[model samples]
Target: MLKSDKLERLELYKDRNTQVFLNKFLSEEISELEPVYDPKVGYHYPIVEAIVGSVQDAEAFLNRLYNAGILERRLYDKIIYCPKCGSANVSVRYCCAYCKSFDIQRSALIEHVKCGYMDVEENYKKGNKLVCPKCHEELKKPDVDYRRAGTWCTCKDCKKSFDIPVVAHFCRDCHTAFTFEDAVIKDVYAYTLREDAKEEAARGWVIIAPIRDFLLENGFEVESPAFLKGKSGANHMFDIVAYEGK
Candidate 1:
């Protein structure tokens, strides 16, 4: 078996910097942590991903941590994903609605106010002479007989013209095409320590380690994580308990 291979059961340790960060939040919650941007991954990772090493299932782990009152979530950036496969690998493309071809070109259109003839700018150009295509009138000045109307695109493949192209998304990974309505939008979140969890860490294990060592140095017996029954018939774990002069 590979040493790195995950098993069904294994011992895990907390109270590392990752957990201590939760404990240290008693002072104030950390915020404004910059994201880690990876060009290859094509996504900006949450700051906690940069801090934690063993974050394989990032979404699940962060959600579980949030449920455990260890971390709180703050609204972060948002991103769009492929609705079909939920992949972030997507691109926006403008294509002709009739033929759905990307081979389209846009050009200006000129309208002759005198004859009420509207055509492309190229049709009105006759060897540097702006001649009206309808009445064959030679144009002299702007707004006199001709005026620039609008612009449109024509599909070179199908020869179909349109005023507006349809918006679309192409999934580079799955090779599937979809419209904007089929796209999935997801919001990412930043994390901070919860107020209640921070308050518990004040008299919790955050300072218990040093206190335990101090008691042992003074010729006293100290039991860390001391378990005792309360009057309510419930067991409670205390951070430290010391006894002396036995």
Candidate 2:
């Protein structure tokens, strides 16, 4: 379709409302939609999840409602993604920068007040005696002689030192490795009905109930749940149909 033609055809109700998500949302007392995540199910976002329980093409149904402007999405949650394929099935782990090993331990760094020097606490160990690395002085009192500066992570494999270990994401599904820069951060969203859509849904069959009754009182035959064939040789069903002089 042409861009201008598509833009002009973007009219409301051009497509029929399936009311799949809307019916489920309206049925709920609390319409506040949120994303619920489980390790087994990955991610479940309200109405879409509810409708997809019995159907296979849940994404298609959601896309339809979204395209019709009946469903509005709100930022809900976030997940880590694989840089290669943009898959969310990824695992995060801290590794050593030098050897890229997972075997790493963290320890506090001690600072000598006398010499104004800071090093790892393990460096000050001298045969069960705390010694200052800088001045090489025997530390008697901990508070007076030295204090803890910060913590440092050391790689057991390569014996390399670092303030913070390198964080890398591993794609479990595709078996891919990506650095923090390469790792993609994606936002998940919760779906809700638009205000106009909610009003339309709220009206529902109640709107047609009065019209059907009026037609019945004025001597007209009403056929509800009527099935008819369309010009395209497709079966069309109507919730209500009225016939005059029948």
Candidate 3:
């Protein structure tokens, strides 16, 4: 599509929260471009617009869009040619993307097979040439050109690419099993930690009775075993160790 058409479609994003995000991008309040959320999931469309803005709006927007598969990315306006087909008709590309060059001479670069960085680096710095498995092009060893700064390895064989990357966020507590986004929701409930013991909770955290009482009043089935006796200066004995529904 034409650039005018693309910008116009962005204008039609239904959620006002999204509009605010986009407006911020236009105004430079945000450097990385990201979709606020998907209207289908994060919230119902035509959000009347927050009269008094809340952080929940932003949080919900990101969580919902992340669940909805709306991509978050850094946006740029610059010339981009496909490193794959060598076509200049590229519609989308990431910052510092290493594209496979179709040229026979540029194939000397080793593009990491996975993320596709072709800008080449120390991973294979010992070598000066690569055989493009795709186009069968061999490129000369890249010499540092300060103007050409991107983290990508050019693969001579596939003429493919890989990214020079960094791990964005990691929780030492959560371990590698979960993503940075996964812990975002649990963070919302963090204040529950301040409550004293003798409460039921999730993920091994302490939960209190008043919060449980509210849930019960709201029609939640808050069950506890009647037999466990509370001992002074000991962990609150849970009537039920963990939930296993009837």
Candidate 4:
């Protein structure tokens, strides 16, 4: 059971929108609330948005429940956003490592295993036949004569060869260009009801009120829902804690 304050906090779920959100889990419609990725919004819980009005409102409500220990949250993904405007609508841009030019060509590096000669595939093309540029050997079979060594890139503007390119991001919303170091990163999480809270969700708080009244009538000071600290210094919640004189 939740503490008295936490139980009071549960009253927020009584709102129609919140009930609709919880009912989905209560009815076993969804076991976990996973976020859907949106290019415009980054990561959002669609079901929560549909029930709770907006994405921001849905996230706030889920966060509140998590804080109250009613829901458990797990990191689902991480998204990068534009730092300038804080928008997730960003596009990735790969540029040449030398001149930062967008005009670059990608080709596979082929190696003649027989002679240990390696070069780009384009240099080995000899009128529909692969001929090793270094050894001038006509390739016959894969692994026998030549094999794909690796992928290589060349900048057309600078005519420089490189194995890796410079990565940057462009914000569609603010039209701002930035690198990974300048982008804002946020963690997205998925939520599920706490194991103990599932049963309480299925049965409303009304059932617990009568039990609390019965204890009070029997000449006892009762905390309907209480937090008790254990010997280990851990606080555990109880449905009822009653004291009859000391």
Which candidate leads the pack in TM-score?
Answer: 4
Q: What's the count of clashing pairs in each model shown?
A: 0, 0, 32, 0
Please report, as a residue range, the 10-residue window in candidate 4 with the lowest summed lDDT.
Answer: 5-14
TM-score-sorted candidate list, best first: 4, 2, 1, 3
Q: If scored against the real structure, what TM-score would every candidate get?
A: 0.51, 0.56, 0.18, 0.74
Model 2 per-residue lDDT at 192: 75
Candidate 4 segments exceeding 4 Å error: 1-17, 203-246
Ranking by lDDT: 4, 2, 1, 3
Tens-digit per-residue lDDT, 1-246, candidate 4: 456546754455445666677778887899999999888888998899887778899889898888777788899988889999989998888889988886889899999998898899999999999998888889989987889988899999999999988998889999998988998989899999878777665444445556667877888787756779999999887766788944
Expressed as tens digits, the lDDT of each residue in 7-107 for candidate 3 is: 22322233455445444434445444322333122222222134225545545654443333332323222222223232323222122123323322221
lDDT of 1 by residue, 1-246 (tens): 222211110111124544534533454455433335433343454545545644354566566555555566777766667777767777888888798887778778888888899988878889989998889999778887788888877888899988888888887778789887888877677777655555555545546667877889998998765668899999776556788936
> What overall lDDT goes with each candidate model?
0.65, 0.69, 0.34, 0.82
Q: Best candidate, lDDT-wise? A: 4
Per-residue lDDT of 1-246 in model 2, one digit per residue for the tens? 233222222232222334444666677744755666655334655445565652235556665666666678877777777777756678887899888886888889898889898888889999999998778998888789988877899999999989888888888877898888887786666777777666654554446556777889999898654557899999776656788945
User: How high is the lDDT of residue 119 in model 1?
Assistant: 85
Best of the two (1, 2) by lDDT:
2
